[model samples]
Target: MSVALPRIDAIRDAAARIAPHAVVTPVMRNARLDALAGAQLFFKCENLQRGGAFKFRGACNAVWSLSDDEAARGVVTHSSGNHGNALAIAASTRGIPAHVVVPEGAVKAKLEAIEQAGAVLHRCAPNTPAREAAAAEVQRQTGADLVHPYADTRVMAGQGTLVLELLNQAGDLDIIVTPVGGGGLAAGCAIAAHALDSSIQMIAAEPEGADDAAQSLAQGSRIAGITANTICDGLRTLIGESNFEALQQHGTQVVTVSDDEVVAAMKTLWRELKLVIEPSSATVFAAVLKRPEQFAGKRVGLVLTGGNVDLEALPF
Candidate 1:
């Protein structure tokens, strides 16, 4: 049988490697949001993080953990927004070249951010297979290490650092909730939260249009061939193979919200908290709106993943 699971100690080490580049973002108590969720909600405002998302934590760690030979080869990956810019920034800090493959429909602001961070960007057809194939080709061309946006162990471990910091900021949280795309952050959350307290309920919030995690959890099997059709472009993908296995084995829960609900949450965070979060980050924020009972009166944690919204691209 496979081993129990990766140790949180490894993730903690990754956190140490990335702390210099990543910010220890504040965990703000939002009374209005807490009242809506019927719980004491601590919003981890990663929207204010460097490179405009929590991906910076993982990207920085992954890049820094590279050996000198690997660093000389540089790094590469495919991402719609946060991860691409994050890797670009991380590689820039190390004076290493970075190559990023992006889908055609990727948000313009994200594309600009990646370019602004000094990464060479290559456009690909907007599909899972094409994106992966394009990224693979870039790696072959550049000999860069393929730093998968979500599936890499180093990246997942680095993402776990967020929860560790959150736990340090606020002790004894009842639950931790975050938006799940390919499961990097969710995997990190599961590893970090449960390692600290096996009782901490880690919930992943997703958009209904691309609710692969929800469907997979219910079906009890890995599901592929499903197309992502969500306005939350950051969440428009299925979980990674190992990520699905981890989620199922760990009993991680998944919740979903509509695109409209995400939009409403975005507006709420902006209006009430004055934070300009993206549609994907709002997915977890919208979770409380849908399932008020589950989080009611609990010390709940919400990871606001990013703030890379292009004002002109707002659906309103």
Candidate 2:
């Protein structure tokens, strides 16, 4: 069966819905980075976003898209960290209850941030099944709308807004790279980038430890069973079916980089651009650095996905 994907109109509407609240995150360039990669790089600074990640765009859009009665009932979701915090903040902004099902041993800083944002937290085993069960329980108890991370149409539409803003701000760009975990950002980006400029290449960066997106694309179907063992905590999840379908239809190429490469790229961003970003965010640069010849002399846009790293826990 063919799945319905987020359209350009939906993305445009999402942009309008989120503009009042979401920051039009800046596009940055670094001479050192450009020289190192042999391409002119444009980094969309989403680390400076409201919840310190591009996740806020989708979370906020989902929260606001709900009807008055639905909002009154509240919202629920499962996340490793960033998405939960974003949804919590979004729910708080709309004055609704937010319930987040978080895996045990998730980054302490992120869990703390979710609580601070006024979301009721439920702890579960550090796996998909437990997280989903907890979220289902919350939804049953509260009759809240289930704002799935990357699976729902509204969240995908919300994420597309990032590339919409990036395309307009970065001028003509030959390539756009984004870290792919649940595939929301990658799928959303593919839609927006292709619609605006069909010639632009959309690339999905995945950690070698968690390369389901790459394997799925290769196998012509979604693949699960790979054990994730990377420092990129935000990117360890399996891609949702809807998101996988979107990637396939949009012709997004997936590339895998080593965890060491991800860490190196993270340090580079911090030193060269003076920007603090999480390991997941650095995957985009890791992909580019891994294949400089592919992007040589081109204007490449990289989405700096988040900056929610715990200061004490340096991967390097």
Give me the candidate number with maximum lDDT.
Answer: 2
lDDT per residue, candidate 1, 34-139, as tens digits? 7777788888999888899999988998899999999999999999879999999999989999999998989999999999999999899988789889988988
Q: Give the alpha-carbon lDDT of every model.
A: 0.87, 0.92
> What would the per-residue lDDT of candidate 2 be over residues 212-238, giving only the tens digit for each residue?
999999999898657898889999999
Instruction: Evaluate model 2: give its lDDT.
Output: 0.92
Model 2: CA > 4 A from native: 1-3
* Residue 21 local lDDT, model 2: 86
Error of 2 at 175 (Å): 0.5
TM-scores of all predicted structures: 0.97, 0.98
